[model samples]
Each structure stands twice: as C-alpha cells, then as structure tokens.
Target: MQAIGLIETRGLTPALEALDAMCKAANVRMAGFKRVGSGLITVIVEGDVAAVTAAVDAGIAAYPKTGGQLVSSNVIPRPHADLARMLL
Candidate 1:
C-alpha cells in the first residue's frame, strides 16, 4: 500500500462515523475494521500519502461529534509491503 491510516475509537458509532468521514474526505479505501475488545474499534484505510493523512485527520475530526472516545489515530506513508499482506 502507498499509505495506511488507522483510527481507533471507544465505541462502534464513532468508529463507523470516522470511517465514513475518512473515506469521504480523501481518495482512500476502507481496507478493514477490527474490534480490539473492551468496546474499542479501529478503522483502517489505504491510499496515497497525502490522501491517507487527510483521511486520518478527517476521521479524528468526526470523532467529537460522535460523543464517543477517540482512542488513537495514525498514518503510515509508504508502509512495508508485508504490512499489506498482514493487515489488508
């Protein structure tokens, strides 16, 4: 993948909202989502570096409106190919 963005939240509502915002804010694809227990959820997206960065920011911005906790967020530019196989 050219880049990857991940956003973690405390509830499903914020996770889904953030995912939607991420996809809509940039030319990124919603690659996957995961539940890491304790009501924590993570949304993953992939795209170009700039797009991934913008998407991750948008996802974070959408979190406050959700009234759910924003756990963490990150963007990886030009990630290792192995990560795609493992994460994608």
Candidate 2:
C-alpha cells in the first residue's frame, strides 16, 4: 500500500533537513515538494503507512523543542492502488 503524506513545518531549513533524514530512514520515495505562496512547504512522500508515519514523526521530532511554529501532518491514499487493502 502506498500513501501520500503531507507535512507542514514551521521553517524551511529544519523541515527540509528533518525530511532528508526521515526519507533516508523510512526508505520512502520522495515525490518532490514545493513552498506554496503562503510559506508552507508541501512534502509529498509515497510509501506505506508506517513509513509515512515514521517520516512524520522524525519531522516533528527534528524541530527544536521550543520557539517554533506549529507543525502538522496529514495522510491520504495514493489513489493508484487497491483502496480496500490500502485501508487495511
């Protein structure tokens, strides 16, 4: 099953750095990302739920413990696979 995870981080450098490490650890294929006009970085990563979760975890953990903007994440089906099995 494949999932597209979107992580919205506070800053660019830390977010990108954490993303790099998480990507390395999770072994998920990155589908590229871009900074929207609203200063949000859209991280599009494709992999299993565990992989995406780990990546998102690493991202949140990578942020400094204090004085940072809010960090959030969301997951969606990749839409190119078995929806039933993927849901499981």
Candidate 3:
C-alpha cells in the first residue's frame, strides 16, 4: 500500500460509521480493525496516498454523526515496509 489511514473511535458504532464513510468517499480498501478494550476501536484502510488522505478526512467528518468520540485519525504516506507488513 502506498498509504494507510487509521480512524480510532471510542465505540464500535462510530468506527463502523467512519469505515463506511472512508470506503464510500475514496478508492480505499479495508485492511482490518482492532478493538483495544474500553470500547475503543480502530479502523484501518489502505490505498494510494491521495485516496487514503481523502478517506481519512471523510471518516473524521462522519465520526461525530454517530455520537461517538473520535480518539484520533492519521494517514501515513510511504510507510516503511516493515510497518506495512506488521499492519497488514
């Protein structure tokens, strides 16, 4: 992947909402997700840099609609090979 996007939310519902918005707003693919306990969920997406950026933005924008707090969001362009491997 040229880039990876992550959206972390306080609840699964908000994370799902973010994932839905991300996928619909860009040509990105779901990598996977993890629940880190305490109701925190993180959604991951993979795509080209531009796509990832757009997807993350869309996810962030849609997050509040679900009434779930967003923990954080990030887009890493040209991530290290090892990092990508570990994430995938």
Candidate 4:
C-alpha cells in the first residue's frame, strides 16, 4: 500500500480505458485523476509496489486498444505520505 501508479494519456477515452485496465489487472484502487489541460489526462491508482507495477503495465499496454497514445506511465514505489493527501 505504498505505491502510486500513474498513466498519462492524450485524451479522456484513453485515460478511462487505462484506469479500467489497471484496476482489473491488479489489487489497486483509483486514487484520483488530473486533467492537465490541452487534452492531457492522468489517471492515478494506489496499491502495493508489485500491484502498482502490474497495474501501470496493464494500463500502458491497453493504450493501443484505447486508440489513444500514452503520454507516460510511472510507478512511485515509495511515494511521500503528503502526496497521498493531494491525490484525492
């Protein structure tokens, strides 16, 4: 429960698809999301280290199916506690 996974995409559809894939691929929960302006969106999930890794991978892999390009994917293995407060 110390990891935070993020998948950033160019559109809302891709972001939503990635979010769904992430939750289905691992023991993770949707922490929140951010609309970074100019059509960019980032989806965040929280879980254990391994779970977050798997979730992020699944999210990235689903980008093609979503028909939207992936901007980036990241897993913060030991995110600061203060960051958690800002997520949701």
lDDT scores in order: 0.92, 0.67, 0.94, 0.90
Model 2 agreement with the true structure over 8-84: per-residue lDDT tens digits:
66667656766786687686777657676566666667789888878767766665653456467776755556653
Per-residue lDDT value at 21 in model 3: 97
- What is candidate 4's lDDT per residue for 56-82, written digit by digit as tens? 999888779877889998899888878
* Cα lDDT, model 2, residue 26: 86
The numbered model that scores best in TM-score is 3
- Taking all chains together, each candidate's TM-score versus the true structure is 0.95, 0.69, 0.96, 0.93
Please write out the lDDT profile of model 1 over residues 1-88, one tens digit for every residue: 7999999999999999999999899999999988999999989999999999999999988789989999899998888889877877
- Locate the minimum summed-lDDT window of 10 residues in model 2: 79-88
Model 3 stretches with alpha carbons more than 4 Å out:
none
Model 4 residue 43 CA deviation (Å) reads 0.3
Positional deviation of residue 71's Cα in model 3 after best superposition, in angstroms: 0.3
lDDT pick, better of 1 and 3: 3
Model 2, C-alpha of 38: deviation from truth (Å): 3.2
Candidates arranged by TM-score, highest first: 3, 1, 4, 2
lDDT of 3 at 60: 93
